[model samples]
Target: MMILVYGGSGSGKSAFAEKKITELNKSGIPLYYLATMQVYDAEDEERIKRHRMQRAGKGFTTIEQPKDLGNIALELREAKSDILLECMSNVVANEMFSDAISDPSIYDKKVSEEKSFDKYEGVFNKIKDEIIKLKDSCNNLIIVSNNVFEDGNIYDDETMKYIKTLGDINVFLAEISDEVWEVVAGIPVRIK
Candidate 1:
């Protein structure tokens, strides 16, 4: 079963997703917590630490796979497992720079040739295909994602590309998911 849970930041969606995954685990398979967040700052580090604490006794073996999801199934061949993709936003953001399109910290005077739009589409497409393969490799797949499309704000082209790509991803997953949920103010509202 592919369950997709999504909401705004601080919407308690992650906790909800974990609970659902734990409840749906019937085969006693390994629960794989796919952590996609890249720690680039102290705040990011602390957030990861806090998430660890929250899931300390959840009986999950965390796998840090940020770029490639297809290889994840290869890592645990023939062993039945359940997977929970922590969030799609981070994965999308990391893939945006997967090709070294542009790095603000390293490149002061940017001179790149790669098309950001083409590169990002390729990244998203790969993620989509791998996610389908991952579903076949696992007993159940619980995906967590952020709902950032509702915010009314103007962003630069790069940020817009990320948002648009993530939006497309969410729509695609919603169509394929067995159940879809949207958590608001710590309350989960089932959308599908």
Candidate 2:
């Protein structure tokens, strides 16, 4: 079964997803926390640390797959397990922009100096494929994602494309998910 838990920023979505996935792991099978975050700065590092602290002693074997889901081939093929993908938003962001972010001359380059952002469709397809493969490998798949379309601010073309991809991914996941939940103000509201 695939479950999606989503909400706006700071809506306690991560906590909710963790608790739900832990509760679902009743069979004593290996509970894998497939984390997809890439630490880009000090703040990101702190956030990652906080998340690790939150899930400490939760019986999850953390596999940090920043962009490549196929990295953990042995875990997927060896046994059936429950996998909690910590967040899809990070996965999408990492896939779509990690190259530029990792470039040696990144700090010297300005936004206008870089190439145009043209990989939205490709990144979206890649993310969908990764999710499908994850579903095939895990017994229960719990995905944490952010609800990013509600803000009224108008964004640039690249930002808009990113937003659209995330929205599309959410719709696709919700269509196939056994349970879809929207966390609001620390409350989990079942939408499907």
Candidate 3:
């Protein structure tokens, strides 16, 4: 089974996703938490720490795969374990902006204008394919993503590209997921 949980920041989406995983594991199957956020600053560190505290004693074995989601299938020890991916926003950002996957020159104004934001379509397709592979490798896959399109503020070209890529990936996830949920103010509202 595959589930997608989405919400804006601080909407208790993670908690709700965790609860759903626990509920689904009635047979005591191994639970894995695929931590996708990379710590780049003190704020990032603090947020990761808080999430760690929240998952304490939850029987989850953490697998830190900030990029290359498909590679996680090789890192898992058990074949029938359930996996929860905390967020897709970070995954998309990591893949889209990383010097490893994308040329650093892409950010240069001259280069950006020449290449156009359409370059992100490749990143979007890569993420979608990796997610499908990961889901196929696990017994159950639960993905938590942020609803960042509601801010209603225009951003710079680079930021807009990242937002659009994540938004597209979220839509793809929702379409493929067996269950879809939107959490608002700690309430889990089923969307599918």
Candidate 4:
């Protein structure tokens, strides 16, 4: 079973996803939390700490796979665990803006020029494929993703690209998921 939970920041999507995963584990399957956030500053550290506290005593074996979901699939191929990916937005950002991309200078130039979305097509497909592989490797996959497109503020080219990519990923997830939900102010609204 695959479930996708989405909401804006602080919309209680993460909490809802956690609870749903726990409820779905009546058969006592191994529970895995795939945390994708990478701490880059004090605020990030604090957010991580808070999330840790929130999921404490939830019987989750946390795996810090900040990028490359396919690698996590490989590592957990035998576990048959029920996995909850904490957030997809961070994963998209990590993959799209990673320093490991070949020819960072050229990539930056192309991104800033806003020439073509195809420049990010490779990234989009990589993330989509990795997510599918991860889902196939697990018993049940519950994904948490942020809804960041509703904000009406304009952003820089690179930031807009990131948002667009994440939005596309979320749409893909929703289409493939057995169940889809949008959390609003701590309420889970079933959308699919």
Cα lDDT of all candidates, in order? 0.85, 0.83, 0.87, 0.89
21, model 4: CA deviation in Å? 0.4
Q: What is candidate 2's lDDT per residue for 58-170, written digit by digit as tens?
A: 99899898887755534585677898987888887787777767884752463556545456778888778877877887788898989888878899766787788888888
Error of 3 at 24 (Å): 1.0
Which predicted model would earn the best lDDT? 4
lDDT per residue (tens digit) for residues 60-79 in model 1? 89999886888987776577
The list of candidate 1 runs beyond 4 A from truth reads: 98-116
The CA lDDT at 84 in model 2 is 90
| Superposition TM-score, candidate 1 onto the true structure | 0.91
In the range 1-192, model 3's lDDT, one tens digit per residue, is 999999999999999999999888756678899998877689989999899999998888898988898788766535778999989998998887665335556456444355566679989988888888888788888999999998899997778888989989999999999999999999999999
Model 4 weakest lDDT span, ten residues long:
106-115
lDDT of 4 by residue, 38-154 (tens): 777899999999999999999988999888999999888897889999899989988876653546796767556746777578788999999989988989899999988977989
